[model samples]
Target chain A: MPMRTVRFLFFLLSIAAGIGLGLVYGWLIKTPDPGQLTPQVLRADFKADYVLMVAQVYQRDQNLAQAVQRLSRLDPASPARTVAQALLTARDLQYDPADLQVMSDLSRALQSLETPAATGEPAP
Target chain B: MNDNESRGNLYLFTGLILGLAVGLLISLVISPVEFVDIDPSAMGEAYRNEYRLLIAQAFQSDGNLQRARERLALLREADPARSLAMQAQQLVGEGASPADARALALLAAALTNPQGIAFTPQPSPTLPPGEEAQTTREVGQAIFTPTPPLPTRTPVPTFTPRPTATPMRALDAPFVLESRQDVCDGSLPAGRLVIEVFDRDGNPMAGVPVQVVWGQNQTSLFYTGLAPEISPGYADFQMEAGVVYTLRVGAVSDTLNDLSVPACGGGVRVVFREGR
Candidate 1:
């Protein structure tokens, strides 16, 4: 091979090696701190369990406002949306029928809260 | 010729360094690994606190200690009961909702003493009159059959009510002063008032609120179980020498007067137990 070509090939190989090392370091060597993680990143099943917990609390306290506030921590987009997603996950995971019931109850309550506002009627 | 070869080698080395930098930038900044399925143990401090709170509230709602323990295990705490007690105390200190603090404390107590403890039902918040029935109907509609039957999954045992189950003792049962003793140990803290609370069955009860008042109604409130190392149902307060104090446990406990550092120079130990 020509001397110039050989040098060029070596340069490209070095770059490839460097990229591999960088990927390893970034992906494996120095991952994000676990303590800094947010609840939004929780596993789908765990997220469902968390939603179920809020539902249970609501069952006892009948406090819709507090339930919605707690659910918002897990998913900021919407509390009702969060519960609906959790209900689906719980069904797929075969969560206890009682637990599924609780999540569904929460989903319905949250939807009810939104319905009045969406329909341009004064909230009941 | 040697100098040219060295220059070429340097160029290759530079290329490698440039590649590494770019790779790290991409991996760490632009497209860092997103955590989608982490367990409770890996959660950040705030989320973990929220998880613990939820666990406590669930325990309160259902009165299930074993389930609470299993859920707490997900947090991976060295001492789940103690962690809960400390968090409860901290929550109370921070002036958070009394219900929330009480829920945490109740769970901590249950973990400390497995024997059943009666808890007052939390007052349900009232909703608008028209919406109450609607909410109830929605909750009633949630009972449905599972779409997929998993024959492999073992059936969960149904909870059976025991006809002869012993009635649980109320957590707020009036507490009577059982014993008062003066400690003379030099090693122990001076002028400290150590209080221990117990249930009727003699099991140490955790999370009973102890109140101390002195000098024109200046009061201090603390809960038991803060020092699980000594005992789950133990709490202490420091008393100034010659300052008289009155102490009480729970909401309906009889007050004991003239509580002060005894002349023996160690401290006073008071034991309280549930009364009929």
Candidate 2:
């Protein structure tokens, strides 16, 4: 081919190669990596709040055993630990073996906590 | 170079430049971008308004005219917005003491502009009717000083029943048994028999299963299957005259350890002479 034609072809090929490199770079930058995102950690405050709420419900049901069990499961260093300890102390002061219903309800509640959450339900 | 070749080269270069420019413009236009929508001025005004409402509610709940007056005074200094200042001035005039009223007024005034407000003491305004007044006063006192003495009432004493102790006969074998009645009169008894088991160390073990067997002649009087109810740690068996009965308590723990007392095998061999 003549010199002018050869130079024109070289220039056209260079532009095409540049466009292809640009497209590849864009695709690589935009591609997402599933492993890069970490699963969300439960906030410490939320955990404490949940434990306190469950403890209050158990206390209302007069299930001291269950309340104590729930209290024991709470993070010992959490701010809610003081509340749990207070409740446990109060329960010890009033505990009576003759209160069979209270005892049974407490055992049942504590056992229920150990069971896995039902399908499509959030864990407490 | 030749005329045709030069023209072709010029055309190609122009096309590439135009394509590159267009692509760059399209990328810039389509790229995702985010912006904050809240107006800073409006946010500041909202904070001021919220603080005002909180202070007013607090004063109403506490019934502390003095604290209310002080808060209004502070509010007047901060905002001087004719409406807020006038409201604070009115609260102060309404029997609120100078010192407490002044403190509240100052807090409100300091919060008039967001810049001066350190932390909005978002007083909980939704307290129950019964607790509203007490809680408001508590909040006031908490801010001004330590909590004040709460009204005290003596608690009434409650009575609890004590468990009764009944003398039980010692079993020579592994167990001793007792029932509500040795013989039945066809009418069911009102109460149930409760059995308690204690380990050698005397601690109670829960969830022990017991098997009871009873019968008269060739037929069983009442099998464990037919009993109406049984207490925890105990088995109920219906009694019929002219029947021989036996009970067997079997536990896996007993079988695992040779010395572990079979939770079973407590015979209270009662040979009834007459129906009671």
Candidate 3:
């Protein structure tokens, strides 16, 4: 065989070998386990549900002080709370937290409001 | 083997090594792992499904298709509503469970018209002839205040269980005492306790009257969800460490021992659900 022929054959063999090994790696070497049935996921699910509960509370009373207090119990800016608030503002779809404009407005508002309190305590 | 043959074998080996490395990289990049942090996939299907459902609910409630799409894009579903109708129809196919069909129908409707879902306010359930007069009012208007205007009993029904197959009281309503911390946030310096209540169906119950009794007959009455609109279903209260609080709502109540918190100071949240 010519030199070029030998090189071509070698390349083909290499490609075949590589494909075989890659298959092994993709299937047998890799394992997937749900591992999702854990306390952490459970807690996250409950928190998500709780956010809905909070929204219902807002609908009932429109009491902002209690709203802030409860939201603070969870993370002040958590996605759960965000979902709740978004749901609470259902009167106008444009104002929903899911809306890009509303989300941007909210972010800007939060950033502007984010000055350290004069109380010398950490900012909430 | 001859010299030429040996060199050829070496070239084949080199090619093999190169191909293997490239192939390995390709395999891993295409591999779909369930958990991004654990399995190397950015996001798993589980989280995506949850995101989809949440966005669908939001769209159904708000009728904001644009907002729903924006939220969906965050999860890499740039064109979320494109197939929402198909997917919803599939879920709403014949023989689907009633709840699933209703949810999917809502999703489909929202996909068509975001602002179309109209929620009729549930009519206040009527009470017995004599008792009806006292209890007939807005669901949350009868909140009990903890501090000012204390201890004035009114004709408004406070926590009386209604007799009906379906309860007037929302199922999810209850006081959720969240926090494992011994100290309250600096925002409310004297505030150490937060009480959150949810109505039945797990919605936050607002303006429900409650009594927080700590110390000797030291009673303070208030309703949950008196917080700012940003923070709903929460009431703020201050409690001294080592003191115990007995929270009475309607007929049932629970006690919270501040001493239960470690001196190291993480907060404890004592959740009180209605009728619990």
DockQ of each: 0.44, 0.03, 0.12
- Mind giving the per-residue lDDT tens digits that candidate 3 earns over B153-264? 2322121221121112332333344434444334434435666654434444443445667778877665443332323344556666677776654334444543333354
Candidate 2: where are CA atoms >4 Å away? A1-124, B1-173, B176-210, B213-235, B239-246, B249-276
lDDT, residue B115, model 3: 32
Which candidate's TM-score is highest?
Answer: 1
Q: Distance (Å) between predicted and true CA of B190, model 3?
A: 51
lDDT of 2 at B73: 43
Report the poorest 10 consecutive residues by lDDT, candidate 2 chain B.
B136-145
Candidate 1 C-alpha lDDT tens digits along B58-172: 8766665655666787777999988887888788778777667667777777776655334433323344566431110111111112122222322221111111112234566
Q: lDDT at B248 for candidate 1? A: 90
TM-score of chain B alone in model 3: 0.32
Task: Compute the lDDT for candidate 1.
Answer: 0.74
Better of 2 and 3 by TM-score: 3
Candidate 1 positional error at B151, Å: 24
Model 2 clash number? 24
Which residues of candidate 3, in runs, are more than 4 Å off? Answer: A1-4, A12-124, B2-10, B26-276
